[model samples]
Target: MSEKVIAIILAGGKSSRMGQDKAMLRVDGAHLLLRVYQVAVACADNVYVVTPWQERYEDLLPVGCQFIREARYEGDDVKQVETHGPLIGFAQALAEVNVDPEWVLLLACDLPNLEVEVLQGWIEGLENSRAEAIAVLAKHEKGWEPLCGFYRKSCLLGLNKYISEGGRSFQQWLDQNTVDILPDCSTDMFFNCNTPEDLRRRLL
Candidate 1:
């Protein structure tokens, strides 16, 4: 039996460092978000983009990609909705997923170098993943690369527990769970275009 897979792409970041919406950045004639979405579509059974502003990208994405409106933190102030980080955004999106996919591929919109073949290879190995593991992710010196990785759909229970208890850091939540290390791949594949200089380097 093949594992059913669904992909969730995170585009809810403020992009403070990039000085603009990273999803809308153009590379090789396609928006970065569209590029990542295309890769996800090729590798997974379904693809969903999670963000607060769905209308912003509805025109950019193709017909198959679905959108989940990320919730904003409401406060007493009528004009102030706190910007929760990616972990919360991911948790919310995962909770809203209608299908029971065995694995969920989580990606950031700014990863312009993502390749379908490499991701497919990774997906192929998920069936062999340790039963104790809640996620399969690449580990670098900094820590597990949570944004670009595979998480078990069943992990949402623990994820919600952590979030309800006020945990907001991906690294923190992942640290408390069992995770399998992804086989070594090219480091460039994980590169994030978060800054203007990073975008320039990506183009070059």
Candidate 2:
């Protein structure tokens, strides 16, 4: 089967530690989510932004950019929509993608340093990946960098099974699968704005 690529940018976080919406934060005169979406557009055939607030970002993106409403679960009798973190959010979006032999470029919305050329280079290597490999991701000292990487479309079944079994941690789920480590990547490329301090560091 021929390979097809698509991107999914997760933006449903509450930004509790950042004290503001990181996706809407401005960097170099561009919103964080818009910047990431542009980068994804450069390297992938299609780009999708997964967030709870679609109207907030709809005007920011250009034409052809799609939005996938982040899944929320009802909490208590009040039926408040509650986020279950990136893992669940990712699974919900992945289920909507209907491509065969697909390679999904998954990213967090706060990664402002992402470079289109670097991501394009990574996409070029997907064809060389092993048959058993389910994902191709950069590895840090702690573990695989799950957010900024690529996963096979075939992995949806395994991912859903893991989530149904109460597995939420990306690192935990990755450790149980065979993943190809991304080569020749700089740690700075994965730098994300999670807190005010991180935002300051990015600007400097």
Candidate 3:
């Protein structure tokens, strides 16, 4: 069976280290989010970006691309501010979006060099794999590449359950379920911009 995927781009994080929104950061004349979106469009038919502030990126998004306004969780601090994390935002978007597919292609918009070919290669591997796994994620020498991975829609319930029960650790959450880790994933495709040094390094 041909595996279908709904590409979900995660762009809702607070870029505290980067000193700027990584989504809007320019790369070779185009915004980072737009660059990722352009690559995502080539890999899947239905693609969406999930962000905390939609207006901040409304003009920067590529044409035909849509985003979900990330629902915030009340933080434990005295100020009672809202927090935007990958799990919460992912759950919210999956609940609100109408598109249905065999797998959810999760991506981080900060990856300036993420290629359409690499994304498609992962999908092909998933389709060809005989193992019955809930998700297919890439693992580097350091650890698993959680953001740039594929998750089966069936895992949504377990994921939300873990989050609701005070579980925020991504690796711990994955430990509770079956996941296929793709080895030898391209390092360049997963090179994400987290700090100013990453952008300044010209790694791309």
- lDDT to native, each model: 0.90, 0.88, 0.80
Better of 2 and 3 by TM-score: 2
Task: Extract clashing residue pairs from model 3.
Answer: none
| Residue-by-residue lDDT tens digits, candidate 3, 1-204 | 567788889888878899888888998999999898888888877888887778778777755568787866656773454655887778787777677677888888898888777777777777765456778888666667888888887777888899889988777887787788875676678888899999988545
lDDT of 1 by residue, 1-204 (tens): 556689999998888899888999999999999999999999898889999889889999987569999978778994455778899889989989979677999999999889887888888888999998999999988898998999998899999999999999899999999999988755578999999999999899
Ranking by lDDT: 1, 2, 3
Worst 10 residues of 3 by lDDT: 74-83
Report model 1's TM-score to 2 decimal places.
Answer: 0.94
Candidate 3 local Cα displacement, residue 151, angstroms: 0.6
TM-score of each: 0.94, 0.93, 0.89
- What are the per-residue Cα lDDT tens digits for candidate 2 across 1-204? 335689999998888899888999999999998899989888888888988778888788887678888756666864355778999989999998775547999999999899887788888888999989999999978788899999998899999999999999999999999999998866588998999999998898
Q: Lowest-scoring 10 consecutive residues by lDDT in candidate 1?
A: 73-82
Model 2 misplaced stretches (Cα beyond 4 Å): 1-3, 74-81
> Candidate 1 vs candidate 2: which has greater TM-score?
1
Q: How does model 2 score by TM-score?
A: 0.93
Q: What lDDT does candidate 3 reach at residue 95? A: 76
